[model samples]
Target: MVVTRSETQTGAQTGAVQNSSEGWKQQPPYRTTEGDEGFEKKWTAHCHCGRVRYWLSRDGPLASKFCHCVDCQALHGAPFQWAAIFHKEDLRFESGAEGLAFYHAPDKSTTHRLPCKVSCAYCHAPIMDEGRNMVLMFPGIIKFSDAEHKKLFDPQCHIFYSQRVVDIHDGKPKWSKLDGKSELMKEVEREGSNTILGEPKNENMQD
Candidate 1:
């Protein structure tokens, strides 16, 4: 998943919107979501400044997890990333359409990310991680008026927990890497924990 920046932006089911072209960017590196079955206005996520809005409609998410990858630590500038995966078709933009932005996600090992990150160009609030076949949205960004909606955003596990800078004693299962793709460890389990990278990591950081 990608972090965020301060540029700040939206779109429809697909195709086009207003006088804009195929992608938000006049050039490339910009692209744009579906569905009704088992779908309801499940959750709403907005940026830190509320310039960008994301409306998620789905019966449930594919997965919800806290990510402790180094990239997440640096990019999001958080102890870990709380991300919920959903079908692209199930996600849609609700505001800041004119100011959508993109940044290459940091993957030093490969340094390869095509449209790795998507956020509001205005407030730089990360909207989604448009990697793989689905989109990743911040569960924390979701606005829930009731306890039920809030519970839907709860994370099931922690990914890349080995790189965790802070300890989470919430009792969720932590994985050394991807679930099923790597070994599993409890939240209290770790060989040698690492302290937070540095202070003031969230300088100019978005929610």
Candidate 2:
């Protein structure tokens, strides 16, 4: 709802005016004047090229999940994509929305192994995806709160990395193995249980 300007234009992604003006515009009956409750305040984000954009509400703690399905690997061009989850109402858009694209891999049948993919309309940068329950937003797209938010709500778990190209053996972060070998596996594989660490672990968690 606020705008500022400097001197001359710079790069396509850097100098371009952010579409925040439109994305954060107040809804009617929801007065632009301060102190509107229905008007939810949200964090806005966009691709470097000013193509893909997103908005996130300031409600709820930041959370994450690592997806290792093969399609996820191809989509992110890595072992997995670490996504931060918030509610859908928490999201908003600004520009280049028409160019948003999607892809479904061969492993998909009833539904795509990878359900969704969002990219920059101009630069073609993959922005986010609908993995399980929460939309997997690329942390790099977020522009609000900067370092503080990054430190608090980054990726916490890695999912399906075994089928991914990059191996998760660094031990730099916590890791979990998949299940379904037997009934004992199911019993031992309860959520939040860990034998190696002598505690409960959430094995093969979704969302």
Candidate 3:
């Protein structure tokens, strides 16, 4: 989710092309057959401006949730965060590798987040999330056509919702607790600086 200044410019330039590609990738009208057993597949989710991109391919996602944490609300500038959970190996990012950034809010919990915040770094659209298998992606970024949006996501529960400003009276279940761990943090520690993929050094900030 890290969005730096320069990535913004490149993202804007490629947005149109990416959006056009999105039109074709929209999920099917009806849910297609799930991938075969033992089958592996990959899907891509990109920042609106396209500078930051990722691929998700592993065994199907373990679970997905729409988060309504205050951090999520502020990050998204929207009602909640839409995220899918997958094994760490399921996610990968390409492009603007240097522009990938990190932030830790001392006022908030000790959680450090990937770039893309402060103002929508990519789309300037007011929604971003930390990157890690644990961080959620904006469903909007999946580039699924409108038809796909209807089928692929209908978040079953909302997490960290006690912090949500609006009451989620839609009968949707709300979860307000979190286990303290940052997936990216663990990944970086294990991989160290010279990661197979470029890995940014851990920033020394109070979480």
The candidate that achieves the highest TM-score relative to the unseen native structure: 1
Sort the candidates on TM-score, descending order.
1, 2, 3
| Tens-place lDDT digits, model 3, residues 20-116 | 3433123211112244243234566566566666565543345567665555555556766676554434444543222343333322322222222
23-75 per-residue lDDT for model 1 (tens digits): 43322112122232443566777788877766777856888888877767777
Cα lDDT, model 1, residue 202: 19
Poorly placed runs, candidate 2 (over 4 Å): 1-37, 59-62, 106-114, 131-133, 167-207
Q: After superposition, how far is residue 75 of candidate 1 from its true place, in Å?
A: 0.7
Q: Each candidate's lDDT (Cα)?
A: 0.59, 0.46, 0.41
Residue pairs clashing in model 1 are 7-121, 7-122, 8-120, 8-121, 8-122, 9-96, 9-99, 9-100, 10-97, 34-89
The total of clashing pairs for model 3 equals 8
> Each model's RMSD to truth, in Å?
9.9, 15.0, 16.4
**Model 2, global lDDT:** 0.46
Q: Clashing pairs in model 3?
A: 1-115, 1-116, 2-115, 2-116, 3-115, 3-116, 11-49, 26-145
TM-score of each: 0.68, 0.55, 0.49
The model with the greatest lDDT is 1
**lDDT measured at residue 47 in model 1 versus the true structure, 0 to 100:** 85
